[model samples]
Target: MRNKIITVCTAAVMLVMTASCGADKNMKKGEKFLAIGEYYEAAIQFKKAYGKTPPKERDKRGQRAAKLARCYDRMNSHQKAIAAYRNVIRYKQDTPETHAALARLLLKNGNYKEAAREFQTVLDTLKGNRLAENGLESALTAQRKKEEGSRYIVRKMDVFNSRRADFSPMFYGDEYDRLYFTSTRNEAEGDELSGITGTKNGDIFYSEKDDKGKWGKPQTIESGLNTEFDEGACCFTPDQREMYLTQCTSDPAYPRYATIVTSNRTDAAWSKATKLDITRDTLSSYAHPAISPDGEWLYFTSDMPGGKGGLDIWRVRITGAGLGGVENLGEPVNTAGDEMFPTFRPNGDLYFSSNGHPGMGGLDIFIASPDKKTGKFVLEHPGYPLNSQGDDFGMTFEGPHNRGFFSSNRGDGRGWDHIYSFEKPEIIQTVKGWVYEMEGYELPAAQVYMVGNDGTNLKLSVKGDGSFTQVVNPGTDYIMLATCKGFLNHKEEISIRQTDESEEHVLQFPLASIRVPVLIDNIFYDFDKYTLKPESATALDELVKLLEENPNVTIELSAHCDYRGSEAYNKKLSQKRAETVVEYLIAHGIAKDRLTPVGYGKEKPKTIRKKLTEAYPWLKEGDVLTEDFIKQLDKDKQEMCNQLNRRTEFIVLRTTYGMFDEKGNLKNPPKPAKEENKHDEDEIFDIFIE
Candidate 1:
C-alpha cells in the first residue's frame, strides 16, 4: 500500500512538470519549424502555445500570438492570421511590422475600412513610412473599385474542377475542341503525396467535347507527359507539333527545382520528355511555361539570379536555333515580391500575376502594357471579379477574344486554386482586305502579308476573289502588303481602335503589273544635276525597302530626260542620275549585283500605262514628246506630257535572279502565261520614243 501511494505521487509530479513546460516548449518548436519555412507545422505548434498561455502573462501570450499570426499568414490562412494578430494587439505586444502585416491582411480580406484605419494607426506612429502610405491609398482605391462593380461575368468552371487543385487551362487544336489543364486530384497518376500541398502530385489532364458541345470528363494525359512528379503549366507550339511544360523534380535534402521540359507530338502521341537547356544554373527554379503567340519566344517564371526579386518573369528565344539566354522582365513587372504566370493575348499584351504591386491582396492578375518608347511594362489591375484578395493567376484566353478560363483560390479559405471562366462581351474587331489590280480586275493569285506594330506578322492567302479577312485586336497599327508573281507590291496602312465604335475596317491594296515600266513617283534630282534632292529621299527609301523585300528579282533603275538637251548630254546626265539612285539602294543594305543603272535619254518617252490610259484614253501608245507634238496640245495637256516624260522607272531585268539552282536552272519554273493571267493586246501596250 505504501509503494502504490509513492507511485501515484510520482505520476502526479511528472504530469505537473509536463504542464509547466507546455507553452514554452511548443513555442520553441514553432520557432524551429518557422525558421525552416514549414509553416503548416509551425502554425499548429504556435496555436498550441498560444492556447496554453494565460491572459495575465501578457508578454508570453503576445509572443505566442504574434508568432501564430505570422505562421498563419505564411500558410495562406489570412483570416486566422488576422484573428491572431488582433490577439497580439489586445495583449499590447504589437510592433510596427505586426500592425503593417495586419493591415495588409485586412486589405486582402476585403475589409477596406478596417484596413485603412490600421494603416493610419501605423502611419501615426511610424512617420514617413512609404509602405503605410501606399497601403492606405491602395485600400481606399480598392474600396471604391469594389463599389463600382465589374463588367466581367465570372463563373466557376465546375465541370473541369475537383476538390483538389485544378488550374492552368490551355485551349488547343484547330477547332479549340481540346482543353488541357493541370490538376492534383486523388485520381491523378501519382501515388506519392506532395510535400508542398500534401496532395497527389500534379498531372496533365485533357477534356474533349462530344457532339452535344459539352465537355466530357477529363482523362489523364499520356504517361510520357504526366509522371509521378509535379508536371503542369503547359503550352503548345504555334503548329501544335511540340509542347513545353514545367516539371518539378523533388529532392529529399534540398528544395524542389522546377524545370521546363519539351515533348514532341507525333502520331497523336507525345514523345518522352527532354529538359529544356535554359541555363547551367541548377539552384534556381523555372516554371510556368508560356509560349509567346508567335512561338518565337518562350516566357516562364524563374528565381534565377540577376532578377529584381523572388520570382521574375523571363523569356528566351526558342526558334529552330538553340534556346537563347534568359532575359528578366524588370522593374514594374517585378518587385521585391513574386511575379509569375505570364501569358499573352494575340495582340501581344502581357497578362501576369503579382503580389509585389499594390492590389486588393495576395496575388492579383494584372495586364501589362508594353511601352515601345521606354521598353518597359506599365501595369494595371484587371479589377474586381477577375482579380480578388486570393491567389489569382494562370489565365488562358479562348483564342483572341476576351472570354477565357483562369485559376484562382478566391472564396476558398484553403488556398486551393480552381478554374473559372470570365467573359466581357464586346464588339470583335476584324480587318478585311482586298488585293485587286489597280485598274482592270481582281488578282486571284495575289497574297497579302500583314505586319503589325504589336509584333504580329502573317501571310494571308487570298480567296478566288482576291479577298482575305483576319481578326485584329483593337489599338493596333498594321501595314499590309500585297504581292503576286508578275505584279509590283502594293501597301496599305490600317489602324484599329476600340474607342472608334466601328466594328469592321476595310483595307484595299491596288497591285501594279511588273511587265511594264513601273513609275517611281516623287523622285526628282536638282536642276541639271545627278544629286537626289531632299524631297526625293522618301520615294528612294521606299524603293530600297521594295528591293529588300523582293530579293529574287533583279531590276534596272533607269532615268529618262525630256527632249530639251542634246541626245549625248541627256544620256550621260541620265546615267549619272540612275547611278545615284543605285548608290542609295546599296547604302541601305541592298545587294549591288541586284541593281543595274540605265539611261534612256529621249529614247524612251512617256507612254500611258493602263491606269493613266483608262483615265485619259486620248493618250495613245508609242507617243513621243517631239516639238511638233508639243505645239499641237493644249497648255495643261502639254505640261502633263512633259511631266510624264521626265521620270524614273524600274524595269524587271530578271525574275529568276536568286531563284536559280546550282545548275543555273530555275528552282520554281514559271507557270504558263495563260495560267498566270491572260494578257490582252487591247489592254496591254508599251510606249517609247526617240
Candidate 2:
C-alpha cells in the first residue's frame, strides 16, 4: 500500500515537470536539441520560437531568429537559413558575428558574390577579424573559380540512387563493372532506426551493369557485415582479397565509437569481419579506411586525441603478417576541422575531404601528393565541380584519368549524400622508351628510374623486349635513367610541352660496351660548310647525353670526310667540323676535358659495320671506301658509302670519369639528363602508355 502511494506521488510529480517544460517551449527545446547536434529538429523548434516572440521583444526575437538561422545552416538548408538571417537583421540590431555566420553559410551554398558582400560588411564593422577576412578571401576565390567553369561534368547517378541517403561508392572486382555503396533507406536490413542519423542503420549495397552497360537496381549485401548498426566506407587491398570497412556500434550507456574491420574474400563471399588492431589507446573513433597502392599502408580517419582537431587522417603499415603503429598525416592535410573519406590514386596521390582547410564552406575534396625530394605531401585543391559547398567526399577513380564518381549533399536541404559522376576531357600524353645494347641484343632486365620536376619518382618496369611506357602530364620536365649490370648508365631528359593534342615521346637508350665506337645517328653538316644545321641539333644533343652518361670515360669526337674534296681541304674542313661538335658539347654541359676532337678526314676510309652490311647485302663488313673504290660500286652503293663516310662518331678513350673521390663521395655527379634526338615517328608509341 505504501509503494502504490509512492508510485502515484512520483507520477504526479513527473506530470507537473512535463507541464512546466512544455510551458517554456521553443527557445529551451531548440537550444537543448542544438547542443546534441540535432540540427533538423532544432531548426523547427527555433523557427517556432521566432514566430511566437513579438517584434517588441527585439533582443529575444533576434536571438531566436539567429538560432533558427544557425540551425538551418547546420542542416544545409541554404534558402531557409538566408531568410531567417535576414529576419534577424530586420528585427534587431545587426552584429559582426551574425553577418560573418551568414556569409559563411552563403559561401557554403555557392552564393559566392552575395557571401562576399556579407563578409565585407563584417570586415567594415569589425576590422582585422580573422574569420571575416578569411571568409572574404575564400568567397572571392570560389567566385572566380566557379566563373572560370570546370573540366568535370558532374551529374547525379539517378539510375542507381534511391530517395534515401546513398553514398561512398567503390569499384568491386578486377573488371570494375560492379559498384558497391552505402545506403540508409527504409528497405535497409537493420531492424532499428539510428538515433544519431535519424534513419535506418547504414548497410552496404551493390549494383552491376547489364549487357547494355546500364546499372540495374541496387541489391543489399547480405554478408552479415551489416548488422543492427552502421556499416559503410569500405576499401580493398591491392590484391582485392581483403575488404576493410567501417562499423559503428551502439551502446546504451555511452556514445558510440566507430572501428575498422577487415573481411577476407572466400570464393566470392565475404567472411566474418575482425576488428583491426590500431596502435593508439586514445583513438575514440576509427573509420574510412584506404589502402595504399602498394598495399603496404592502411590510411583511415580518426578522432583520436593529439589530432589537429575534430577528426584527422592517420595511417598504419600493413606488413606480411599483421599491422603496424598509427601515425598522423599531419599539417597541410589535416586541419582543425574534420578531415575524412581518404582515397588514393594508383600512383600514390592522396585525395581526402575536409572542412578544416579553407573551402567552399562545407567539406571539400583536396589532393595531396608527396614531394619526391622532401617527402612532404603538398596539398592541392582540384577546384570547382570536383568540390562544392555541400559535403563532397568519397572520391573513387576509374584509373589515372580525370573521370570518376564522388558523393555530395549539395542539392539536398536535409544534407543527404548521393553518388555523382564527374569527368574531365583531356588529351592523353605519354613517354615511351626502349633499352637495348649498342650493337647486341636488347637489355631486357635493365632498370629504368625516372624523376620529374612535378615530384614524380618511380622505378619503371620493362616488357619482354626491353620496351617501357609511362604516362606523363604535359608541362612537366622528367629525367629518366636506364642502367644495366654490364653496361654504362644512360640518361635522357624529356621536356613535354603542354598541348591539347594527344601525343607520345620516344627515347632510345642504346647502351655502349666498354670497348666500341657509337655512331651519332642522323647527324649531318651542311654541304661544303662545317656549320651544324638546325636538323642536326637533335643528334648533337644526343651525343652530349652519351658523353655525360659515360663521364669517366673520355671520348674522341671524330668527323670523317667522304673523300670528294682535296685531302688538305677535307682535313681542314673535317677538323673544323670536329671542333664545332666539341664546342657544342661543351656548350651543352659536357666537360671539355672529357672530349678530344679528331678529324679523320680522307685519311681513314669508311668500313661497313654489321648493321650496314645487313641493310645492304651486297656490301661486306670490311669494305673500305676511297674515291676510286666507290666509282667501282653501283650508283646506290656509292651514295650509301659516301653517306656512311661523312659521319660523326664517339670512341671511348677511358672508362672512369671520377664516379667517386677518396672519401667515397661523387666528384663529378651527372646532372639530370635532358632528352634529345626525338623524331615524329615515335608518336606511334603514345597509345601504349594510355
The residue pairs found clashing in candidate 1 are none
Could you tell me how far off, in angstroms, the CA of residue 450 lies in candidate 2 after the best superposition? 9.6
Best prediction by TM-score: 1
Candidate 1 structure quality by residue, lDDT tens digits, 35-83? 5555666777888887777667798889889988887776667788999
All models: lDDT?
0.79, 0.78
What are the TM-scores, per candidate, against the unseen true structure?
0.62, 0.57
List model 2 lDDT by residue over 308-342, tens digit each: 88799999988777887779989889876689999
Q: For candidate 2, what is the TM-score?
A: 0.57
Model 1, residue 338: displacement in angstroms? 2.6
Model 1, residue 277: what's the lDDT?
76
Which residue pairs clash in candidate 2?
A: 493-673, 493-674, 493-675, 552-656, 552-657, 553-654
RMSD of each candidate? Answer: 17.3, 14.9
